[model samples]
Target: MVERATSLACDPSASETGRLLTQAFQTIRDDLEVRQAFPEAALAEIEQAVADPELPERDETDVEFVTIDPPGSMDLDQAMHISRDGAGFRVRYAIADVPAFLHEGGALDAETRLRGQTIYCPDTRVPLHPPALSEEAASLLPDAVRPAYVWDIRLTADGERETAELYRAMVRSRRRYTYTEAQELIDGGDAEEALLLLKEVGELRIAREIDRGGASLPMPEQEVGVGTEEDGCDYTLSLRPLLPAEDWNAQISLLTGMVAARIMLDGGVGILRTMPEPTEGAVARFRREVEALGAQWPEGMPYGEFLRTLDRTDTRHLAIVNAATFLFRGAGYTAFDGELPPEDEQVQSAIAAPYAHVTAPLRRLVDRFGLAVCEALSAGREVPDWARAALPDLPDVMEETGRRAKAVDRACVTAVEAAVLRDRVGEDFEAVVVDGVDGDRVQVQLMDPPVSDVATGSARLGSAITVRVERADILAGEVDLRIVGRDEQ
Candidate 1:
């Protein structure tokens, strides 16, 4: 009878806990204003274009691009295929061509600008572009000939870039593969010819980048899942490693972003994403923490250089390295009107150079704006007045939108975690200390069914301990855990 009651407390439906979760989600959805009012004439034009039997002509014969994304994802934006060219590799990146369908100064454009970017909440999403366009017409789906802005990158065997070219084109994707499927193929040596070549090129590029002081942090991420008959909604914190192919693909985007930044810098009148390097005081504090945790980072080197070294070490110090990375300043958009940013703020360590995000136009508004600027500059014409006017406000808008998106995402994850743990009030679990903020509540990571929570602890950050789940409120989106024991010194 006790076991039955415990099980009922965490039921997917009918349980008080589940009902509270559902209600919380409903409240969030209601506040998002899902129904956006778009101009009718613009909608009619877009529908008419998609409905036409004959679309624009495209050549998709030389390259067979394929998309890799999460399962059940509808708004695919990128496709890639790689091949060997002499002693180097040719990487073809095809991004969805959203601008082709958009009429300048149209209703859809206004609506997208208002929304800024996609906001993903627990139960709903405030998409930047309407689903009819973003998910269906503009998505680069398998067997679909879609318009795209393609970048062709050529790299030597040692992963040094030899040449690059950018142009607009149409492409047909040969297949759609998930991350897991692609990983299996690459690991088992059974990947398709194109995918195999891509993986090899990616490996070389990653090695070279790391050698050139590029830092990659390996941090554990939390993923939420809707449970089945046995369990209610659960939160699983897992280690998601970057696959070779994924890194290879990311390099293409990063390369383009750097190129975009260079172009803007040379042109002397454009918007840029800039981030200042970490301060010496901040680096010293982080070093103290590292030493306290009995970790070794190279002495007498720049912070960025030290970070690169830490990232290449064993898994035990992974979280510490991540915490160190947090000390760096955030990246933001800045307008350069024939003058450079303040000398101290001109460099961005994230991209290894100042950059503007010109990829992922289907999902991001900034990328679309940047693409428009690139097009105008390439044509030897001045940027549109509206786009140029947007330069001043783009920074604040991007920052505000980014903050809101992060809040919504975190709130949803927290609500789900609370729902999952509501029934196990007194269960003990093993956890690692993630942070020791506020002195009273230290954040810890739990194992069995992974989750992160604040607990009372004597040890500081990076300490491992056992904790008991004390209380949880699904609607409030909170979980209370208490430290029961610590690892012996």
Candidate 2:
């Protein structure tokens, strides 16, 4: 059973937690210069386009495509259909056809490049495109015949790709499912034939991923939500488990990205999401830390395979995942034309393959350009002049927007963590010391509320202990604690 704190008051007449969290995040939004609305000219352009749509001439509405996303998400980007092809599988992944509506050098086009990608705050989103197009017209909503960039991928039964092609077409999604819903259907063996194929192909793809030295650390996620207390509304913090279907669904996107990268490389002109291989020094440091924590790492085992063997829910294992973030640095976009980027600049170490961002055109600026390039190449047509010109400038713009988006996410989480623990300043809570042991403080995860904060404590890495909340400043999103005693496992 998941650990729980029985003493937390569930009823709130004032809703103190919720109110504080909202106010704190709102402060973050204002401080960050997050664009709240599009300019009038941009809005007018989007409105006019929505009123009279220009859909792709080719139709693919006959295929029974279905979309899987978070519950209540309207900004749907990708829809999929999978089927058995004799001894292999044929997958059709439909991406939002944003370029169809985006005119080169138009108001919407310039504005999207400036924004780069969607910035998601818990309460509101700074959208890349106006919602009229991104969430309504361009989104892959059910029953809607939407324009899409469809990737036709043929794969062997063992998840090896044989061929991939891209084209513009109109498609209609038949059903929409949330992650939880899809997982339930798969677990109960009540999923449709297409979804069953998704599981089959997904697992095979994962096995292939492992074989190629790819590593994915499935850590539990910490989320903040609004809940009611006797005082009124409060911030509800929870640690959510990663579901299997979610991973299966993600494999499809990764496959699409890898395929997109290959297409761009073959064409010798495109942008890629690249990361360098981790250095020996970083690996050596991690090995020492894991050994000190009593985690086993057999000699000759790749780090990725070793990580797959751990239970993600264990305290030490979770800490190891957090520490592994050290090796996942220096990710960036590399745009090239004609001559290919060097081999070191073309790899994404995590996937053990070349990769590009081409799946979510509705949310990301780069995907729109990537899709246009792939579409032109697949049709034996020259790449558009506008797209070619923008390739060199895309990397800097994407990097700026990425930093803003990440800042918002981190600030919101920290704010909520502060608000949730504000009233428990004197209380002692169970925690695991994640790191900072050689310094003046340690990073700890509280058991009940699943909050992570820094505490002044003398503790070994991965060891559990009791901590007393010393202070909490909700507005600043700061929480201070002190270690009390070592937890005997």
Candidate 3:
């Protein structure tokens, strides 16, 4: 997952720091050649198709689905409703039907193919489809009846998959909720039946993930914006600790994706998201780092379980989690036809499962194809000719777009970090030596402002130290800091 940054709803642009942040984003976009406007033909196609979408004959609108997303999310992708099913649970997940508007195979299709997926920065989003479709027409907005691929998954009370199926249907989301709101409702124990069931099933799925040896980096996302007196500053960069609801919502998506992978693999044709397990060398190195931070990785404990024990709030634990990123390397798409990829070749190492990206079609190009393949297979029909033919090229397209998206996200993070620290240059602060990326340079996580940047000189990885910021340049998205002293306590 991208290290996502949130944009708080404050007028950061009203301050000088905000101006620099804006300029930095614009420069990054310019250098990277991020597209802002849709091609004329794509826009024209959108105009022609927006009002009239091809809805599937099967109407599942009776199910009350609700969307859980980050605040300010417009290109909503997935909606879910969970309920009791005798001794099991029934999960109805609706993914926005992007293909419902695209059989013309026209300029809009070409445009979405070129873009690949939505690229999100703190300031703006470069959507896969135009706003007319992604944020509207095709989006599963509340009260708007829209076409969708609904995954009907039945899970035993223990959260084991009992049965799963996918089909196209019309769906309507009853309401939209930000993760925080959902958490509040769930915590108060006064939510609707679906949400209450969501909590139960979500916890069950989480335990399943832990038991299956899957790990997730539970690092808090950093958000920067104009700060109020309530925040005790004029501008602030702070961590937004994820809500329990967010993890629960994600479990539903993962459940659907894994089930979709099963469907496609059973049919012997589809794309699978694949990654290799961490190397012995990587594990050894991580173990060493963990010991250096005064943490214990018990003998024979799965690395995932070990990771789940680390608290993200502790300075040493934060560094430990940051170092865990190395374990998630080399993830990519695996498209297949006529036969399945080798067993080892199909599993996503981090997820520890054979997974496919079948959710979030509005944001991702590949999911549209994956969903088409899975939906066809689950419906006992031939995979669409167009989907089968495009399997070979999907990997490369996704790889290229993935690289671009990462570069942009990293650039935006850097600029924001620089902006946050520009006024504090020359100040000393407590930090943890997270890791060394290059010769004589280590990455440090600051305590006061919650910023992570490269600093000169070497130190034991995960060791506490004091660092002096020598310079910060928003335009360059760079910060110069030096290790002045090591923390003894």
Q: lDDT (CA) for every model shown?
A: 0.69, 0.85, 0.85
**Model 3 RMSD to the real structure?**
2.2
Model 1, 1-489: lDDT tens digits are: 000012223444455665776687655545544334456876776686566523335566457898887665677888888888899888788887777777657777767666677766444455677777788898899988888877677888787778765566778888999877887898899989877876777677666666655555444446654444554443323444445556666776776776667666766667777776666687788888888777777776545455545543244564476567666568787876667777556556654566678878877878776766765665467876767766777787788777666666666667777776887889988877766767677877676566766787556677778898898888777888899988845
Error of 3 at 29 (Å): 0.7
lDDT for model 2, on a 0 to 1 scale? 0.85
Per-residue C-alpha lDDT of model 2 across residues 302-354, encoded as one tens digit per residue? 88888878786666576788778788889999999999999988999988999
Q: The CA-based lDDT of model 1 is what?
A: 0.69
Residue 421 of model 2 has an lDDT of 83
- lDDT tens readout by residue for model 3, 176-286: 988888889999997898988888998999899989999877877776544664543234567766777888888999999899888888999999999899999999988
Q: Which is the leading candidate under lDDT?
A: 3
Work out candidate 2's RMSD over C-alphas.
3.7
- Which 10 consecutive residues of model 3 have the lowest summed lDDT? 1-10
**Colliding pairs, model 3:** none
TM-score of 1: 0.87
Is candidate 1 or 3 superior in lDDT? 3
C-alpha TM-score for every candidate: 0.87, 0.95, 0.95
Best by TM-score: 3
